[model samples]
Target chain A: MSPHLLTLAEAAALIAARKLSPVELLEDCLARIAAVQPRLDAFIRMNVAEAEEAAREAEAEITRHGPRSPLHGIPVGLKDIIDLKGHPTTCHSKQRLDHMAEADAAVVARLRAAGAVFPGKLATHEFAIGGPAFDLPFPPARNPWNRAHHPGGSSSGSGAAVAARMVPAALGTDTGGSVRHPASHCGIVGLKPTYELVPRAGVFPLAFSLDHVGPLTRTVRDAALMLNVMADGGQDYTRGLTDGLRGLRIGYVRHFHEKDQPASAEMAAALDEAARLLAAEGAIVMDVTLPSLDEFSAVNRTILAAESSVVHEEWLKTRPQDYAAVTRRRLLPGLFLPAVDYMHAARRRTQLLARVNEVFADVDLLLTASSMDEAALIDDEPEVERTYPRQARTPFNVTGQPAITLMSGLSSKGLPLSLQLAAPAHAEALLLRAAHGYERAAPWKDYAPPC
Target chain B: MTDEEIAALVKAAGLEDTAARYPADVRAALAQLARHKGQLPRSSDPTLEPTPAYVAPRP
Candidate 1:
């Protein structure tokens, strides 16, 4: 198999056994990226020179000594919003076209220590907010499954790259389901670690309290391999990968899709089949209701608008024309949002977390619908706007819990369908366990976008 | 919000160009903001309902 097609874990194993060279894997990924990038538009900037040098060094070191870790020599893509020492973190925007980073983001530093290679900066929404936009410095990424469809964002490039087999792993930030959205729409695994689990010292801030850094990979096991290095003093997230969902109580958050927003009939059926599959494996599936999606939507949007406004206020005031029309439309409301409402949203966040905690006391995991529909045409702005908020991922962001979305099935349109899995705060291990278990039994678990 | 109120707010935020260029978007944003404010729990109502088990600080 082409090294580029290997999951991160499989590539790591081969690399450790001296059968696959880091240089070979990196070059293979680069070649595939060159081939697919024209259609997918998944990368903002290609830092090929440095990545090649690092891959060569990793190969020599591993040959002379031994592998440093599973990620040793693995070529991982960095989201454009991250500061990768000396690279322009364009954030797919014109505002930072000339901005250069003097130091690596903390996560980049950790990955460097783990000996991971970087191929380039992946595409993100403009400042991780506005995306698939025509006015940005670069074009929006398209879904690998269908080049004309949206790939999901603002981690659009990350998801597309992984699904297209251009790279094995990529990092993405989640504020309001950016990570999970792409994961869902891209037919891959997107894990938004608990808030603060992965430090955010160098990541561009969207919503201060809601921002989180996590990994997007092709499989749940690859995601585990990713978190082992991304977070500090992490647990053996892979230790429980084989611990299936037997006897585990999974609370089906049907209301989030069934009543709150009414997911598409296909997506709703996919989620139901996923729950049934898990129950067949001995998972105790039962209905669990939280507050309405609108309630969480209000709290999430209020905090996101107010906090993001603080980051873009000066620009909104002085350089409004520089922003994409979509970005401007999204950020302008924050300028008019009453400060009292922002605070009220924060207070409401606290209340929501308390309520979710009460629910967790009775269940080990929460399952819900993600994306609510399949990928839409990239140019269909109205459809994007309509399906964007019909997700269950934002509630976890508001509550600061760990959540992941993975492929549940496919739509009749040949687009990927997904279901979300969430756990209590700091319960990433359990979240991974349940996701891995579900993926193993899922009919679409091994499904990749036929790129 | 009235068009005049939105234009005035846009002008105050130094985004008069935005109001002129994307009036509908500005109006849409204002409408969504109003809807969000309505969904927020009233301060008088019970806001934080922590179960007796334990109430950890917000993650």
Candidate 2:
């Protein structure tokens, strides 16, 4: 297989055995990015000079002493919201295109220490809120499966790049499913680790309390490998990955899609098939219910708006014209929201966490819909608006649980169909084990987009 | 909410000079929040405190 086609783990194993060169892998990825970038528009900036330097250093160091980690010579893209020292963290907005990151974000620092190469900064929604917007400084990333469709955001470019094989993995921050949305839409593995499991210090703040940083990769084990390095103490995220789900109790929340939000016919069918596949692996799949998706959406949105508006208040008052129309509408409400409402949202968040905990007590993981439908036309404003919030992701963000979205199957159109698996806080090991098992059993295992 | 109410809130935030639809958007937002308010179970007991949002890392 081509170096660009290798998963992180595959590439790492080859590099360790001296069969692959770090420089060779980085060059292959760079070449793929060159070929598909114009069509996909997945990157906002390319850190070529720094990345080439890092790759060469990794190559020489590995030759001398051996690899530092699985990512020792791997090229990983950083979402533009993340601070990478000496690079401008544009957040894909015209407003702060000149804002250079003085220091690496905590996660970036950790990744750098692990010998990962910085491929560049990927596109994000404007300040991680406004999206696929023509009015922004850069054109939004298009879906790899079907270029005309949305790639999902606010982590748009991260998902697009990984799915298109431009990079093995990329980092994305999720406030309300930004990571998982693109993961679902792009047919990749996206994990939002338990809130605060990974550091968020230097990433641009969308909603501080709700914010999370995670990886989008081609495989579940790849997600775990990235997490193992991103978090401190070197916790082994891959330890349980190959352990088949013989007796794992997975609660399939059908109501989230079937009743609360009503996912598309194809998505609904794909979800059922995914549950059946899990059961076929000797797992017990039981129907479970939680607070309505609407309740979670409302609570999550209210808090996100209130907090994000505060982050951008000065900009709104001074340079509101710089923001896209969708971004403005999304941020405007928070400006005048009664302070008491934010408090209520926070209070309800506590109760919601408890509710999910109660469910987790009986089941090892919870399965639900990530997006009600796959990528709609990127240019269809009304359709985008309609499908944007028809998701089960915000509930977990509100509950601060670890959730992973992986491709369940392919739609008739060949676009990726997705399902979400979530666990109680800090149960990412369980999430990966189940997701990895299903990925191996499912028909779409390691399926590449026809970009 | 009435236009007047929306206007007062906008003017209070000093965003009255923004687009004409700004006030209307605020009204719709407030209405949405009102709908969400109905979902939150009211706690009469002062002891049901909200989380500080972050807790120390677990061992």
Candidate 3:
């Protein structure tokens, strides 16, 4: 396999063994970006000169003193919403097109300290909400699996780049399923760790309370490795990778997608098969119920709209035209929401979180669908509008628990189908271990995008 | 809310351009927000607090 196609784990091992030079890996990535980026539109800007310089330095440093961390000398991309010192954190919006950061976001600083090389800033939705929009400053990222389809957003470029092998891994922010939505559609692994596990200091905020920063990568192990760096020395997220699911209790939330918001036939079947595989692996999988998907969605939207409106109130009031129509429409409701309503949502959020926590009393982890259907056509606004909110990922955001999305199967049309697993807050180690166990027993992680 | 009421709110928020461009979306989103607000519990335990569980780490 080409260096560009190597998983982060593979590359890291090779680099540690002195078999792969960081410079060689970077060149391969740049070549892939040059060859496929026009079709994928995955990056907002390429930091070639700096990346090349950093790669050479990494190669020299590794040769001199060995690896600094598992991520040492590995090239990774940053979603445009994340701040890299002296780079524009555009949030994929014209409104902040000229905005540059004087310092790295907390996650970027950690990744840099871990010796990861940065190739560029990846594309995102306009402020991570109003896209796959043509009206934005940059064209939306197209799915690597099928270029005509939407690579889910607003972490559009992060998903596309990792899935297409333009980069092995990238950082993506999730407020309401932004990371996992792309992971589901693009057939990659995306994890939204427990809220506040990864600091959001320099990343542009979507919803202050719900925002999470996470990794989009090809393998669950890679997600765990990236989390180790992003979480800045929390318990090693990869600690229990080989721990089988035998005797593990998994709560299967079948009705959330099957009834509250029914998934496509293919998605429903894929989730069922995934559940069966876990049970066959000796996991005690059983049906568990929480609040309805509608209730969670309503609460998520209320909180998101209210918080994001505060972030963009100045821009919305002064330069509303600079935003895409979708973003404008999505954000305007917050301005109209009464303060008491925002407070009510906050209060209800507390109760809803307690309800979800009640489920963990019986199970170690929760399983559900990520996106309810396949990726829609890039231009199909009606389908995008209908399908975008039909996800199980946002409920965890409301509960502030750790959640992960990984490929579970492929649609009949060849698009990816995904399953989500969530755990109690601060239980990311257990959550990732169970996901790793599933990835080992199931065959979904082995398939890659046609790109 | 009626069209005029929604329109007046839109104008008041300085989103006349957004109102003109996506009048229905604006209206629907507002209505949805109102519906969600209505679902909030009217009475709650006095001990319940709205603060999130996260505590910021020391710098």
Candidate 4:
């Protein structure tokens, strides 16, 4: 039955029906991770014993108490940047390797309370921004779709692990498309819940302003399920929304891809097909214009660089050499940012935010190519700064909104091209519903990489 | 901002202890970026509202 590869939603249903046991599920996932870790290097550490023990308890809980939630017995991976009590939240940096958290980050606590079993922490770009470089103590995670291709970063390992089916879902932080970029490259569903809808406490910050924690899953429903639990109590819940896209307003930022970045042939075709399917399902597809793309990326960079510098200032000063060249060079500018250019960027963000909000007045959601382009070969090296120039993710980051990426089509080389959905702040439920409807109509749920 | 200037900033920032040992070319590039920093407009109003803050507070 390929128990190891079941999506979170499928596995949860089977467990609920007593057709599968958490123990059996956990073992299958552990075995898969064992088989893949050497080639993929997705995990920083594994607590097989702890995971097994938890599974046993979960098995008993199902017998004695029934399921606690969709993830009640589900095994979930966490990016190394999030704090899990008693484990080293290393953020993939040696300087912080020994730093242990005394309590789970708020999201971790919520996941645990909801009955998720933790197998271990996964790898990440050093401190979430310095990666696809080799000088770190741990190797960067390889993409599951093709080991030789990049998995994208800062949430590199989480994307690799989830796409590999080594774990059904994982928690990843998105600051400037960290989650969606990797999901697009690895061919999975990555959801960045509306900014601050999931609390950031105890999670290491890259850019306090841009950093957001969300789920990467094999299915939109799984992401929706995970979002329900991960969302803060004060935040809105979109789980009850199953309206199926009728009469929904969907804005296609086709210009973002068609006229601006020029998506690959496969990507363009996929966008057209996705739009057609959604229109057939009753979504009003309209063309919407965004603010200047260059200005958006530049402002996003300025804010992220400046803020991330503040977060890493201590390490940058104490063990600056410990950082990879990319991180060091990228972060160096923040130190000299004069604090006012940073302010100017912040003020500009206001104007841009208003424009985005105004666009939403005519539409419920915005769509664009998840990435400016498709996946690149693992061995390919571009100039460090040019690696992600003009990412489709900066606008969401700049606006502090929720965004998601779904596999829309396959590239010429057979890699996946993704469609991105961005919803107004705290409107993840609507975004997920729209994504769920598209996913159903064009269901590219889980096409495993021929690893 | 030459390699010398970057070195000076590192030393001034107290990261002289940790900044990577830059080769002539990399140092030159960083120095160029640092100099470009000088070309950025300096805001007379430095106390503007903080960011990720002005984005309508994420609703």
Candidate 5:
């Protein structure tokens, strides 16, 4: 495999063993970017000189002082919404075309301290909401599996870049499934950790209550490795990664996709197969129920719209034309929402959180379909609009729990299908354990996007 | 909400141009938000407190 195609764990181990050089790894990534970028449109900008310089410095420092951490010298991309000191965090929006970061966002500071190299800022939906939009300053990222398809958003580029092997891992923020949505569609591992586990101090806010910072990587273990750096105080998220699913209880929320939203036959079958695989692996898998998907969607959308409106209120009033039509339309409703409705949604959210928390008493983790269908064509507006809201990923976001999306199988058209696993708040270790176990037992992780 | 109501809301929010430019989108968004409100239960446990706007890190 090319150096750029190596998982973060594989590359980190080689770099630590002195068998690989950070500079070489970075150069390989740069070369991959050059080859795939025109087709994938994954990055908003490239920080080549700085990344190369940083890689050289890391190589020398490691030669003298050994590696600082697993992320040492790993080349990672930042979603353009994240600040990187002097770089423009354009957020793939023309509204903020010239906006530059005065300081690194909290997560960026942590990644820098971990010795990760920044290849560039990856594309995001306009302010992480209005895209796969063509009218944005930057072209929307296309799926690496098939350039004609949408890679999912608002973490579009983060997923595409990682899946294409242009970067082993990237930072993505999830508000109502942005991270997991892209990860599912692009066939990668995306984790939206327990809310607030990673600080959101520096990234542009979508919904203050729903926003989460996470990693999109090629492997479950790599996602865990990235979390270790991204998590506050640098937790060793990879510690219990190898714990198999024997005796582990998994709650399969089949109705969320099967009946509530009624996913495509392909997605439903893939989910069932994933459940059977886990059951075969000695996991005590059983059907579990949560509130209807519509209930969760309502609560999530209400909170998201209200909070996002607050964040963009000033701009919406002064420069409404600056936002993409989708973003502007989505945000405009929040402005007109009665204060009572926002309060009611807040109260309902608390009730919903308690309801989900009750399910943890029965199972170690919950499994469901990440996206209802495979990647739709980038310009297929009707399909995009139809499928965009048909997801199980937002329920976990509403509950403020940790959740992960990983490949489960492929659709008939050769597109990736994904399964999601969510654990109670701060139970990322358990969540990852279940996902990692399934990833090993199943053949999904072995397939790579044909970029 | 009716189109007139949505138009009024847009005008009040200083987004008349936006409403004119993307009338269908603006109406759809408003209708969705209204639907979300309709989905809320008529009543809830008065004891249930709302989630805090900001949660401090646990020590």
Candidate 6:
């Protein structure tokens, strides 16, 4: 069996048992990328020589000490926004295509220390916002499930790569649902750790206050393993709460599904079945109300627009023509927000966080459909903005809490359905535990798209 | 904001470049913001103090 086709945990076990060679695994991955990348376009940049050299070093390490960690010989794809020492952190934008980094981002440094092999930089939406575009330096990634559907963005390539089994795991960033949305659509597990839980020092900033770094993998256990390495000192995710969901309080934001925007029948059925299964496993499930989602959307948009505008102001001013039309058009509004409005948005976020805290006082986690609708066909809509909601993920970003999306079931059309689990501030351990428990019961973790 | 008023805001915001191309979407978003104008209380209000949630402790 190809090591590239194994789940991250499976590959780690094989490496630990000396059944897999890091060099062999790297060759398999490079070969698979050679065969599949032309069609999927998931990778943006790759250096065969460097990856081969790293593989040789990793093989030597495994020979001497068995393995460094679970990721000792694992090959993982990094989103382009993350800085790798001596590599360009292009951010999938022409404006920053020439920007090179002198050092790895903190998380990248940690992953390298853990002995993770990097094949190359993965594709991302333009600057992690305006994308799934063709006008950029690289082509947008195609959905592995059906090359015709949107793979979701801006971690578009990361989701597609993992789903296609090009790599067992990949790093992704989420700001307003980028990672989880793609994971949900692509039939993979995506975890967005609590804000600042993973240091963002070397990442290209979209919205400083809202951007979160996370992992996308094939299973909850794999995600857990990845998180163990990515987590900073402040986050302790090894408390072993993930073994069981027994006696955990899982809150369902039914209104998010029942009222805001109705989900497909298959999705609704999956939610009910998932809730029942969790309940069958001794977890408490009940309905919960959130503060007005509309207001939440408003505040999140204001903050994202205002902050991203600030980040790109100089570039926008100097070379507005270089940006994708969507970003230039979407980002232009941020420059208009008054200082008072930005402050008010921040203050409203504080209020919303308090309300969420009150809700968490009753439950350990909150659940919602990652996306109310299934993946839309690529040509179904010319303008993608109309198909999605503005606040599906804004609440968690607003609260600075950790959240994850688990592959719950498939739509009638075979597209994936994801159940989103959000935990309290800095409670990623509990979040992972709950997600892991649900995953074990549902067994959707092993699902892969038929690309 | 009215079309004329919004255009002025766009010009002042240095978005006159793409203003006509996406006027409705931009105006709609601004109009959405306009609705929040009188709803939120003043930032100086005692109820609006920063919570420990947004505070990142000095590392």
Q: For each candidate, report its DockQ versus the true two-chain complex.
A: 0.34, 0.44, 0.40, 0.36, 0.48, 0.29
Q: Which lDDT tens digits does candidate 1 get at residues A152-238?
A: 998999999999999999999999999999999999999998878888988889988889999999999999999999986667899
**Candidate 2 chain A minimal-lDDT segment of 10 residues:** A336-345
- What TM-score would you give candidate 5 relative to the actual structure? 0.97
State the lDDT of candidate 5 residue by residue for A1-451, as single tens digits.
7899899999999999999999999999999999999999999899999999999999999999989998899999999999999899898887888898999999999999989999899999999999878877889999999999999999999999999999999999999999999999999999999889999998999998899999999999999999888887656878888988999999999999888999999999999999999999999999998989988888788788888887898887677778888788778888877777777777877777777778888898999989998999999988898989999988877888889999988998889999999988787888888899999999988898887
Q: How do these models rank on DockQ, best leading?
A: 5, 2, 3, 4, 1, 6
Model 1 Cα shift for residue A301 (angstroms):
0.3
Residue clash pairs of candidate 1: none
Candidate with top DockQ is 5
Candidate 6 achieves a global lDDT of 0.82
- Cα RMSD, each candidate: 2.4, 1.7, 2.2, 2.6, 1.7, 2.7
Instruction: Name the candidate, 1 or 2, with the larger DockQ value.
Output: 2
Whole-model lDDT values for every prediction: 0.89, 0.89, 0.89, 0.81, 0.89, 0.82
Q: 3 or 5: which has the higher DockQ?
A: 5
| Poorly placed runs, candidate 6 (over 4 Å) | A234-242, B1-7, B15-47, B52-59
- Chain A TM-score of model 5 comes to 0.99
> Candidate 3, what DockQ?
0.40
Report the lDDT tens digits of candidate 4 across residue range A62-167.
9888999988889999999998888888888877868988999999899988889999999898888877877787898998877887888889899999999899
Model 3 regions lying over 4 Å from their true place:
B2-4, B11-47, B55-59
Docking model 6 quality class: acceptable
Interface RMSD of each: 5.3, 2.5, 3.9, 3.8, 3.0, 4.2
TM-score against truth, every candidate: 0.96, 0.97, 0.96, 0.93, 0.97, 0.93
TM-score of chain A of 4: 0.96
Write down the worst ten-residue block by lDDT for model 6 chain A.
Answer: A382-391
Task: Please give the distance, in angstroms, between residue B31's alpha carbon in candidate 1 and its true position after superposition.
Answer: 3.4
